[model samples]
Target chain A: MNKTIIEIVDSLEVSKVYAELSDPQSGGICVFVGTVREVTQGETVVALEFETYRNMALKEMEKIALEAVEKWQLNKVVIRHAIGAKKVEDPVVVVGASAPHRDACFEACRYLIDTLKERVPIWKKEIFKNKTVWVSAHP
Target chain B: MEILLFGIAKDIVGKSKIQFAAGEGQPTSVKELRQTLESAYPDLGRLSSMAVAVNSEYVRDELILKPGDEIAIIPPVSGG
Candidate 1:
């Protein structure tokens, strides 16, 4: 197995991902951090709440990291997510990759975040002033 | 068998876990489990999409259920 860090915590540290993905063999490092935005569409968001199926989410995250490492020849990778309530401007998720070249790191970083959103068993709820809505739960 | 619910599914079911008593006619497959849940809780049926996971991995509806298997309902994911 490669050097991959996958964690789901109550708080997310934006700086930890960069340090975790540092590798002497890597020439480029790319990261994507998702935060709780204050607005969505026309609604003003107060906060965001996240929940996860812990065991499954971790397994899926590890699978995604391993796949990225193999596909992009990455030297190091990290995927971390925050659960519970997050205030606006708080970091919610972070994904990053370090690779031998810029192209690989960039591509893998995109893949890491995108695929994690699609496959991982994590859910986010949007808390507006008047209503709290579960993201993508309905048509 | 017991089915664990998470995300919107948990909200719809109003519980974190659903236990199917053996005498109540247990679902023998993933497809049947989905059907039973949808009928029991119509809200779950109205979701945009959902998936089933067995043993911490996504599985097709045709997968057969076995004793002591870990099953969960995976609603649409929005994590980034």
Candidate 2:
């Protein structure tokens, strides 16, 4: 069976996601990690607080997975996002896709992250040295 | 009368669920609800630039809200 959406936002283990996609039938598996940066918009960010409408966020994520399955002919997919407060260099999001070929895996993984950034309602608050600013939803 | 709140809206409202009364067939646009929310909780008025989404779709201020619609007020995001 093909995997689609796996959503979480706490300290996620990379090995666990890799293990889940290690299938004998799949020829390629691609993974992407989005980390919290120390600076944003030229400001020194101290930390970030991420929040989401949990239930709806999951539903939207699932929809993305289904779309990938149909569009990429993939064997499986996984997406995890961390919620709450996070510091710099922390893994905030992870996405993995497995397909029969490397090209499909790469394409699907990129599409998944890009689409999630545009569609997901998850928001982030940047706590800078001087003040706090809110930014647009990103994956 | 029920609107699903999310993100900062859920935090500011101090609850995830809320009920509002709308006149018969008089759509509750995001703009109208913002005014009502400000009256109910003046503190939220400070966040004047927040956006609204109806039924998981981001919409303009004039979009009419229906009963049982999941309404979300989203602030700007700051994620990587």
Candidate 3:
């Protein structure tokens, strides 16, 4: 089994994540990155604060990686998410998938990101100029 | 049993870990645990949704809890 990397970090480096997915056996590698947005709805975002159930987040991420590989026949999967305070435009999450074919790699990358957002035990708080609110908390 | 809180749950409870004694029913099942928590801390009931995690995985209503299992409350997650 190829090494699957999953981490909840304070900061995310795109170059480092790309370097980790260097699997020569795999012919294709696909990556997806999520960044802090400058605006949320009609309000301007000043920053973002992330909270995570670290242990569960890691376990869920590993589970996601395993499921992606099993479903898409992927060779390697990397899932990383940032926690703590982050300025606008900072990287929030990164997902990389490597496989023998481009189709599997791309599909796995999308599936991993979507599943992570839905299932992982991590929360994001949006900070505006005068207010701070939890994402999805509003009606 | 002690339960760890995150996100909005932490804010509602005003602490990361909350301790409470088992009541008359001493609900061992997560379904009963939810009622116990809501009764103790009414703020938890206001949340749009919340879930219990045992041993780092979300379990269904029927899963019974051991005395010393890693337990935490998960509010609606919104990670990227």
- Leading candidate by DockQ: 1
DockQ of each: 0.89, 0.35, 0.73
For candidate 3, the per-residue lDDT at A6 reads 91
Report, for every candidate in turn, its global Cα lDDT versus the true structure: 0.92, 0.75, 0.88
lDDT of 2 at A8: 66
Better of 1 and 2 by lDDT: 1
Those runs of model 1 whose alpha carbons end farther than 4 Å from true positions after fitting are none
User: What is the per-residue lDDT of model 3 for residues B1-80, given as tens digits with 9 covering 90 to 100?
Assistant: 78899998888888999875765566788988898889988978877788899999998878887888888999889999
lDDT of 2 by residue, B1-80 (tens): 66565555666788877776567534468888777776776656666356667777678888877667778766543333
* Candidate 3 clash pair list: none
- TM-score for chain A, candidates 1 onward in order: 0.97, 0.92, 0.95
- What tens digits encode model 1's per-residue C-alpha lDDT throughout A1-139? 4589999999888976778888999999999999888989989999899999999999999999999999999999999999999998999999999999999999999999999989999999999989999999999
Worst 10 residues of 3 chain A by lDDT: A130-139
lDDT of 1 at A11: 87
Give stretches of model 2 more than 4 Å off.
A137-139, B2-19, B22-66, B75-80
Candidate 3 Cα misplacement greater than 4 A, ranges: B22-25
Candidate 2 structure lDDT: 0.75
lDDT of 3 by residue, A23-139 (tens): 877999999999988977989999999999998999999999999989987778899999999998899999999889999998999999999988899999988989888887534
- Candidate 3, residue A78: lDDT: 94
lDDT over C-alpha atoms for residue B10 of model 1: 91
Clashing pairs in 2: A8-A81, A9-A81, A9-A82, A9-A83, A124-B78, A135-B76, A135-B77
